[model samples]
Target: TQLLEQSPQFLSIQEGENLTVYCNSSSVFSSLQWYRQEPGEGPVLLVTVVTGGEVKKLKRLTFQFGDARKDSSLHITAAQPGDTGLYLCAGDKSGGSNYKLTFGKGTLLTVNP
Candidate 1:
């Protein structure tokens, strides 16, 4: 089974702080994606890092993929109340009828105003 485990299942902090979340797995995947979901809306794709050891930056967020393609990490430069949401890391495997993604349980982040 291709399962991705995320660390710090829950996090709470004051506004204007920094935090890093990790996702690790024993299975290899073709690509990894990070998403942030707000209250009612669906998860929004934050970044997608394909190459091993690859890193991508989006505003105040940085995402990195492991060299073995089995792990990934997300670092937020300065978290805000607006950043409060569910952070999920997903992996895309090769075999699947549709573009299916295996999502982690998710890390719930709460940024106090």
Candidate 2:
């Protein structure tokens, strides 16, 4: 079984501050997905990076997949209080619908207003 290690299990920053969270693994993945879970709610899919060295952006957020496809990161520019949530990274080893995903413990970020 493969494992994805996430850094900085907890984070607290004031509004407008920027932050970056990372997820890494020794095993290669076919695709990697980022998710955000709000209090008392299920995780929401943020983005999916399939190609090595691929980068995707969502407004003030940027996602990057490492060239080795063994890691990824999420960067938030000028973060807001609304962005406070549990940021999780998941990796998919099998490129199909019938496979399970390995998840990281996640970084719990609290953006103070």
- What's each prediction's TM-score? 0.93, 0.96
**Candidate 1 lDDT, 1-113, residue by residue in tens:** 53999988999998889999999999998899999999898999989889999999999999999999999999998898999999999998864454778999899999998
Number of the top TM-score candidate: 2
- In candidate 2, the residue pairs with backbone N, CA or C atoms under 3 Å apart (3 or more residues apart, or in different chains) clash, namely none
Candidate 1 clashing pairs? none
lDDT of 2 by residue, 5-99 (tens): 99889999999999999999999999999999999999999999999999999999999999999999999999999999999999999878747
Q: Pick the candidate with the highest lDDT.
A: 2
lDDT per prediction? 0.92, 0.95
